[model samples]
Each structure stands twice: as structure tokens, then as C-alpha cells.
Target: MRVMAFDYGTKRIGVAVTDPLQIIATGLDTVHPNQIIDFLKRYMQTEQIERFVVGEPKQMDNTPSQSAIHVKGFVNLLKKTFPDVPIEMLDERFTSKMASATIAQSGMGKKARQSKALVDNISAVILLQGWMSKP
Candidate 1:
């Protein structure tokens, strides 16, 4: 079974998946919030996903941010949609900044670096990477 991660947004949700051995994570795609279930259903036809790592926005003081309410609703919907699959909530602060730094280091051109889709995808990858690194 493979592990998956999602960088959720109001408009789009960036997705990333780790190989069965849980070694490397690759950015998969960005999907609309409403289409996520269908997308996952199609993906599961070939791959068995064991768990989902979802980014939870939080304030600097460790309090849930306003966006956390939206995330909670999304989490509830995700749970209802995939009852057998467990979900993990991760504090996502500065993931976007980290992703941007990573992209800059990759030597991508300015246009590519400014692409929101690419940033979201990389952010999802960073989220999964953070998840796997936890002890």
C-alpha cells in the first residue's frame, strides 16, 4: 500500500504519492476540490492507498487558523467518502515558502517558478516528505 498526501485549497487540491516502500514522494497532480473523490477512485483502481496526509493550516501560536474550518469540512467529507482509509492531519506552515525555495534551487525559470499549480504540487510533495520524516 502506498501513502498519499494532499495540499488542500479552496479551488484546487495538490496531490502527491509515495511509492509502496514509502521512500520517495512525487507530485501527482492538482485537482478541483469537487473532483477529488472521482480522481481518487480512479487512482485506487490501480493503486492501493493506505492513508492520506492532509495539511492543516495553523496560526503562529499553534492555534487553528480560520482556514482550518474549511479543512475540517473537507476532512469530514473525505472520511465519509473513504471510510476504510485513515487520515492524518499535519500542521502546514511555511510549506509554500519551502516549496518556493526548492523550486528556486531547482533552477527553474521565473515563469515556471511563478506557476501556482507547480507550487501547489511541490507543496504537496513537501507535505508528504514532512510526514515521512516524523519519528
Candidate 2:
């Protein structure tokens, strides 16, 4: 089984998954908020997902940010949709910033740097990597 990760947003959600060996994480896709459950159902048909790791939006002072409310709702919905799969939350304060920086430093074109979907996809990769490396 593999671990899947989500960078949840109000509009688009970025997804990532680990290899079956539990190795590195790779960016999967960006799905609409309302379509995530169907998306996971499709994914689970071909892959065995052990758990889900969701980015928990937080403020600089370690308090849940405004986005956390939305994330919590998403989590609740996810749990209800797939009661068999366990979910985990990881702090996601600067993931977007880091992904932006990574894209800018990666020498991608100016247009690519401004792509929100690209940033979100990379953010999900970062979120999953963070979870996998957690001690």
C-alpha cells in the first residue's frame, strides 16, 4: 500500500502519492474540490492507498489559520466518503511559498512560474515528502 497526500484548497486540491514501497512521493493531479472523492475512487481502483495526509493550514504563531476551517470541512467529508482509510494532518504554513520558490529557482519560464496549478501540485509533493520524512 502507498501513502497519499493532499494540499487542500477551496478551489483546487493538489494530490500526491508514494510508491508502493513507501519510497518517494510524486505529484499526482489537481482536482476540483467537489470531485476529490470520485477522483480517489478512481485512483483506488488501480492503487492501494494506505492512508491520506492532508496539509493543515496554520498561522505563524502555530494556531489554525482561516483556511483550517475549510480544510476541516474537507477532512470531515473525506472521512465520511472513505471510512476505511485513515487520515493524517501535517503543518502546511510555507508550502506554497516553498513551491513558488522552487519553481522560480527551477528556471521554468515566466508563465510557468505563475501557474497556480503547478504551484499546488508541487505543494502537494512537498506536503507528502514532509510527512514521509517526519520523525
Candidate 3:
């Protein structure tokens, strides 16, 4: 079953999708918050997504981050809109930091690495990879 991952934010949402075999996670695209549901609806017409993995941001002490409130609200709408697709929340404490570092180490250059959209895309990839790694 193919699974999709999303790194949600107030301004932008990063997206990633697993291969059909569910072995590799690839960065898909970044969309504005307002366009996310429509984007997903179009994506659903083309791909058979079985589940959704949403990055659940948390503070260092394991408390929900301030931005998590928005994520929770989005989750509610997601459930109501796509009731057939199961959604799972995955801890996303350091995924952004890790994604930035990964981009920096990849020789992507300072300007590209500084792009929030790229960071979001990489964050989604990281989140999906983490989910795939779990036994």
C-alpha cells in the first residue's frame, strides 16, 4: 500500500509519497495551506494512497508545540474530507533541523538550503523515511 506523508505549516505544506512497494520515500511537492485539500483531491485521482502520515511537531520536552494546534485542526478537516484514508501522527521534533542539515551536507548551496519550501519537502521525506523504518 502506498502511503503519503505531509509536513504541515500555516503557510506551506510539504508532501512526500512512498513507492508502490512502500520501500522508498520521495519528495513530491509543496503547496500553500489553502491549496492542500484541492491538491490532495487531485492527487487522489491519480494515485491510490492508502494512508497519510502527518508530522506531529513537539517541543523538546515532548509537549505539543504551538504550531501543533493548527496541525490538529487540519487533521480534523482531513478526517472529515477523506474519511477513507487513515491518518497517523508521527513525532517531528527535529525533522526540520535534520532536513536542513541534510540539505546543507548535500552541497545544495546556501540559497537553496535556506528555502523554506525545500526544507518542508525534505522534512516530509524524513518523516516518511522514519515511518517506513519502524518495525
Candidate 4:
């Protein structure tokens, strides 16, 4: 079964999808906050996505942060829209920084790194990879 992962942010929602075997995750794209539900609905209709894994933002100390609340709200919306698909939240602490580092190491120009949507989508890929690696 394939799984879709989301990195929910105030401005953008990053999307990533796993292979049909659920072994690999690839960055898809970042969509505007208001378009997430519609994007997911269209994507689900095209692909056989069976699960959604949303990144749960928290502070370094593991306490809930303001971003966590936003993520929770997004998840709730997901539940209401796709009640049958299971949704899980995975801790997303350093995924953004990690994604930036990955892009830096890839030799991308500074202008590319400045694109928040690109970083967000890459972070979503990292979040999904981490979840896929879990036992």
C-alpha cells in the first residue's frame, strides 16, 4: 500500500508519496494551505494512497508548539475529509534544517535554497523517509 506524507505549515503544505511497496518516499510538491484538501482529494483519486502521515511539529524539548496546533487542525481536516484512510503523526523536529543541508550539499544555488516551497517539500520527503524506516 502507498502512503502519503504531509509537512503542514502555516503558509504551505509539503507533500510526499511512498512507492507502491511503501519502501521509498519521494518529494511531490508544496501547495497553498487552502488548497491542501482539494489537492489531496485529487491525488487520492489518481493514486492508490492508503494512509496519510502528517508531521507533528514540536519544540526541541518535545513540548507542543504553536505549529503543532496548526498541524493538529490540518490533521483533523484530513480525518473529516477522508475518514477511511488512517492518519498518523510523526515527530518533525530537525527535518527542515536537514532538508536545507541536503539541498546545500546538492550544489543548488542560493536562489533555489531561498524557495520555501522547495525546502518544505524536501522536508516532507525526509519526514516520510524517517517514518518508513521505523520498525
Q: For residues 1-135, what per-residue lDDT tens digits would candidate 3 score against the true structure?
A: 789999999999999999999999999999999999999999899889999999998988999999999999889989999999999999988899999999999998889989999999999999999999999
In candidate 2, list every pair of residues with a backbone clash: none
Q: In order, what lDDT does every prediction score?
A: 0.94, 0.94, 0.95, 0.91
Give the per-residue lDDT of model 2 (tens digit) for 12-113: 999999999988999999999989999999989999999999999999999999989999999999899889999999999899999999999999999999
lDDT of 4 by residue, 1-135 (tens): 799999889999889999999888999999999998888888877788889999988898899988888888888998898999999899999999999999999999999988899999999999999999999
Question: Alpha carbon lDDT of residue 1, candidate 3?
Answer: 70
- Give me the runs in candidate 1 sitting further than 4 Å from their true place: none
TM-score of structure candidate 4: 0.97
Candidate 1: the clashing residue pairs are none
Stretches off by above 4 angstroms in model 2 are none
Error of 3 at 78 (Å): 0.8
Q: Considering summed lDDT, which 10 consecutive residues are worst modelled in model 1?
A: 65-74
Please report how far candidate 3 places residue 33 from its true position, in Å. 0.7
Stretches of candidate 3 above 4 Å error? none
Model 1 lDDT tens row, 1-135: 899999999988889999999999999999989999999999999999999999999999999988898889989998999999999999999998999999999999999999888888999999999999999
Decoy 3 TM-score against native: 0.97
Task: Please give the lDDT score at residue 36 for candidate 4.
Answer: 89
